[model samples]
Target chain A: MTGSPPAPASLPGDDLLNRIRALRDSPAATDTGLGRELGAVADPLLLHEAGRLLKGVAAARLTRAPATRATTLRVAVAATFTADDVVPLLRAALLAGGVDAELHLCPYDQLGVQLTDPASALAEFAPEVTLCLMDAGALLPRDWDPSALDGVRTAVRDRVDAHTAAAAGFAARTGSAVLLHTVPLPRPDRRSVISFRGGAALGRIWREANIALLAAGETRDGVYTVDLEALFADEPGPVRDERQYRFGRMAWTPAAQLAYAREAAAFCRAVSGLGRKVLVLDLDNTLWGGVLGDDGPAGIELGTVYPGDCYTDLQRRALALRRQGVLLAVCSKNERALVEETLAGHPDMVLRPDDFVAVVADWQRKDLHVAALAEELALGLDAFVFADDSPFECGMVAGSLPQVDVVALDGDPACHSTRLLEPARFAQLGVTATDAERTALYRGRRERHRLSTTHETAEEYLRALGIHVTVGPADAYTLPRLVQLEQRTNQFNMTGRAHGEALTRRLAGDPGHLVLAVEVTDRFGGEGVVGGVWLDRGPDRWTVRNLVLSCRVLGRGVERAVLQYVADTARAAGAAVLEARFRPTARNAPAATLYPSAGLTRAEGPAGDDETVRHEARLDRLPTLTPDWITLVAKEAPAHV
Target chain B: MSDTMTTLRPLVARVSHHPAESLAPDTRFTALGSWGSLAAMRLLAAVEQTYGVQLDLRAYMKLETVGELASEISTRLSGGAETHAG
Candidate 1:
């Protein structure tokens, strides 16, 4: 049985472990069986056991399964205790989340030393994410008077300041995202009765410290606080095992560690652009309690009633997601008029038809409808999440389009909202203003698509749409979207290089580099900043380091406009040669001949390296190429600069 | 074979990579070809989890055969409530 525990009669006690070890060692373990076995392990101790054994198996490289499409996340841990004790749990959690983790555990109580020193193991390891694990006890002063509230407050402030400064310094020095664990509140002791009566209690001090840490994360880039207090509060079992803590300095229980690791992996996935982007829902018994066609508007259970409130609450949850830039879509087996009427006329419906970027209400298969929606949104099938209450529909879509994350909504209606929000599939590290405006942008694209079909020729349609392109240097306001584009754009990117926020900031500020963001608008609406390009200027030559454009604006000649702007800028800067490189990737086949197509001469730079095709055009002989139908506006430089 | 032996035999056989029929109650873990430290830890965790008992660390370290491990689990199950895991 896949992902099911072996029958108790067949594998009892020691037999279960032996079977797991054998399965782990056998060739079949990695081939579709490991996930099942791991899923079957319901007991935390057994899970830990499986994790420990799997670590060795992973190290030995005995399993024959193909490697998952995963990023090898390098993580450095600096804690006040033996934090490496939970590394196995963390690895198991990361594996569960479809990520491979490489951990570097620094010496205990050496967080400051490792973070401050440039040549420390932490810096040398060059982790992409650094975790600073500290407990409340570490920050609390020893032998402090309980009545001295001001003194305790001052001490807490000092500790907070020191921790924030260390985290900021680490991020600046190593270019690593800092994940700070909020200090957990201490367990009740002899002072509990008095401390509970006073405002300046130990718990109060801990709370203030956590708030300060959270504020620190908000004020800095690539720094975030993981809420250990909230994690512990939600955990059903003991948050801390006193025995383990006293024996080996293990701060939290295995369950808590597992939860923390899952959160950390989610954060890492978000940072790496692996999180899901779309939420595709089914209508009948999915978004509402009943079918729109059969139940009709009044008969449908979707208001503030017992069963109706469940569906109503689900709709509100979906609306919340939409507000946070998660694109909503509908794929249901219903007539278009019925779906529209229910969405528009249903009294309990929190989501209107406008909330969804695409509504596929037809008799087509759910998988086909989802695929069409992905195409319409210009996103990969993996980016879509299909949720339906029907088991058959969920199974069909799951089997047909395995890339889509299928949430089979079963069980009581009361639990639907919780189920929908439980998976961290759509977790995001940070949401920019552009993210909030994504649904509107997609809506504008739909309008443009409709307008494109009215004209006979592409040029005629482009002229009729009144397209406008603005080319400008990247600034603080546009940097996030530019970095997001750099990280996420795969299909039309010339070189699939993910220049993160730190590098993008450096390039934008450096005089030797030129980074430009392209914003597109048409008569229908603005598509926001849809593309970006980065150029590294040498002494005599300007090389296009990266050029990425969103697929949403692909057919509208935005790529040509951006490329022409780059060439014009290079020619104006007195550069002798303008060069570009096209590094081919699996998804970047659309960009393979981009440089050559733009009239740049294809040339071989070095012998024996054929992966990157180099193309160059002499600035003196370059021809200016611009689209006549669209208006191009060059943004003026800031007056201060 | 006893019920405990029937239940423990498959686990031992699987871990030791021997035939299930080859295992007996007195089969020592040290004699098992694949019974290394890692395997032993895995065995300890699985047995504890499956039986809902926490074997004492000292007693666990002293275990050598299938019967000894099973006896330890039985004793723990009868003596006290299931121990909380960390």
Candidate 2:
């Protein structure tokens, strides 16, 4: 949970400790990894320990990762107490959120001086953003009598006005954005009087002071706030360490400090203008309980039952995010007809067809769909977040499209909304009506892809491979490579059996099955036994049980020889027909067309959704040939090994 | 060394920039060359968090050695709750 607990608090993990130890004292290297690990931390003691470990490292030395390329922001921190303790935590949190901050902590207990004095160190730093923190304990009178509400209000106004004016003056002088948070009410003062009358007066007066500061600071030219008062109501814990306060005027408790630091980092992110815009959601388990294909439109779990409510909850949350101006899009694999049918007709579905900016429910790989979505919207992949229930899809997007933020909507459907939204992936200071009109504001960023051509030209890089292909029987040397390809090969695989080593070994001796290992060698090096074909021999027809090719050799255009060899072997052995199962799993679309492209056609009637479609060809009509660019060498295993 | 001393020594070392093993029970906090107001405040903050003990800053400063600091932790760990952590 992003909110601080009553969470199980423990010391920092050994992994974090090891990373801290391995960190070099180099000025150039960014502490991005350290920031990532610390970002997951919520417990005050653990974060404090991490800060203590990172105490010696100067904030300047630990710049955020250069991957984001956000320009370094000069931030000045002015607080009521000694703020040295806050810098490490703030730096870690800022770096975690991908904001590269160069922080300057104003002199201890000089919140007003730093804001007003032109010759002060804070003014010299020339900050882009100034984080101004206040303690209620420092602001409110110690002896706030229940009778003197007006007097306490005057004193609070007098103390707050001085700093607010100084802050406005500073922003006017330097065009620097000033950030302030509503100061929390001190516990001593809150408990100092217990009657209903006393409590009511204090609560009323305290809120007035907080609102007064908000009024003065935010309405000014370039000032914003991280609302601590609202944050406390959401995740309430002790706000002050009275002992620390008594000793050094350090009022914030560990959780309070962390919450403030995290929100402060969010402000920094908003200032740096790094936020996700498009949320690419997947169907099946993510939007409903079960696979849509298996359950059918009416059969899938939705708003009426146990786990279905969870999906509804997530859908409701998605609509809420859309209201905040985060565009929603769906990227899923299904017959587009069924997807549209369900969206239009489903009784429990909170989202409708019109809610999404685009719906790409097709058989193509989703990474391509997401990229096309971005290009269509004229934004960068960095601005997109792809969330899916399947780890395969998540892994695919994360590996190929590293710029996109991928969220796995696996595990309990109940926590799906929290998991998707928790990173503050779409953090913005506040959304105004003006922002809705400013859609062109995002189209303006040019660090984007034409993704339409990324894949079509990917094979262009392979032209220099000087490719060669070799097909041999599956045997001792080639068995390991063949087994790996059978388990891992997906797009080019006829059947997704994901066969293991034992199954491959057992099938090798079964005479009824024939396994051929295909290897590719390029100018660079041999790619081992990177392709494999498994066949089952029957009296009437020989079935190609699985024809799998490794991605390493996909673009080399050698699969024709592989298919031709199998057809000839079956035909020579007196088999009249050659056939293979073609299942259109969202993933297997690329494989389904492999046989049709090589002169095979679908057998007869329409295939059921669950049943496999059979593609067959007369053995005599074979017309597959290896391309001129590839030289094929066929080998046979020794008789009976 | 006492359990409190075992827990307190490393934290003291952190603030003072001295090795934990080098700072014995009798090593005076003020005697350390690095001991200053900032270090003292840091040590107190760490001490309060580690032991769940809320110590009087004035009284804590009056103590001379690491042993005395550890003893204060032991006393507070047993009884006394001016403002202990939950």
If scored against the real structure, what TM-score would every candidate get?
0.84, 0.64
- Which pairs of residues collide in candidate 2? none
TM-score of 1: 0.84
Per-residue lDDT tens digits for candidate 2, residues B1-86, read 67777767667765675666677778998789867765676677668767767787668889999988988888888885454343
lDDT score, candidate 1, position A543:
87
Candidate 1: DockQ?
Answer: 0.22
Candidate 2 stretches greater than 4 Å from native? A1-11, A26-33, A43-67, A216-218, A234-236, A304-306, A432-434, A437-641, B3-59, B62-86
After superposition on all CA atoms, what RMSD does each candidate show versus the true structure? Answer: 5.4, 23.9
**Clashes in each model (backbone N, CA, C under 3 Å)?**
3, 0
Query: What TM value does model 2 have?
Result: 0.64
In candidate 1 chain A, where is summed lDDT lowest over 10 consecutive residues?
A59-68
lDDT of 1: 0.73
Clashing pairs in 1: A3-A36, A15-B11, A254-B86
Stretches of model 1 off by over 4 angstroms after superposition: A1-42, A49-71, A100-109, A141-152, A188-195, A198-200, A450-464, A599-615, A639-641, B1-73, B80-86
List native contact recovery per candidate, as a fraction of 1.
Answer: 0.21, 0.00
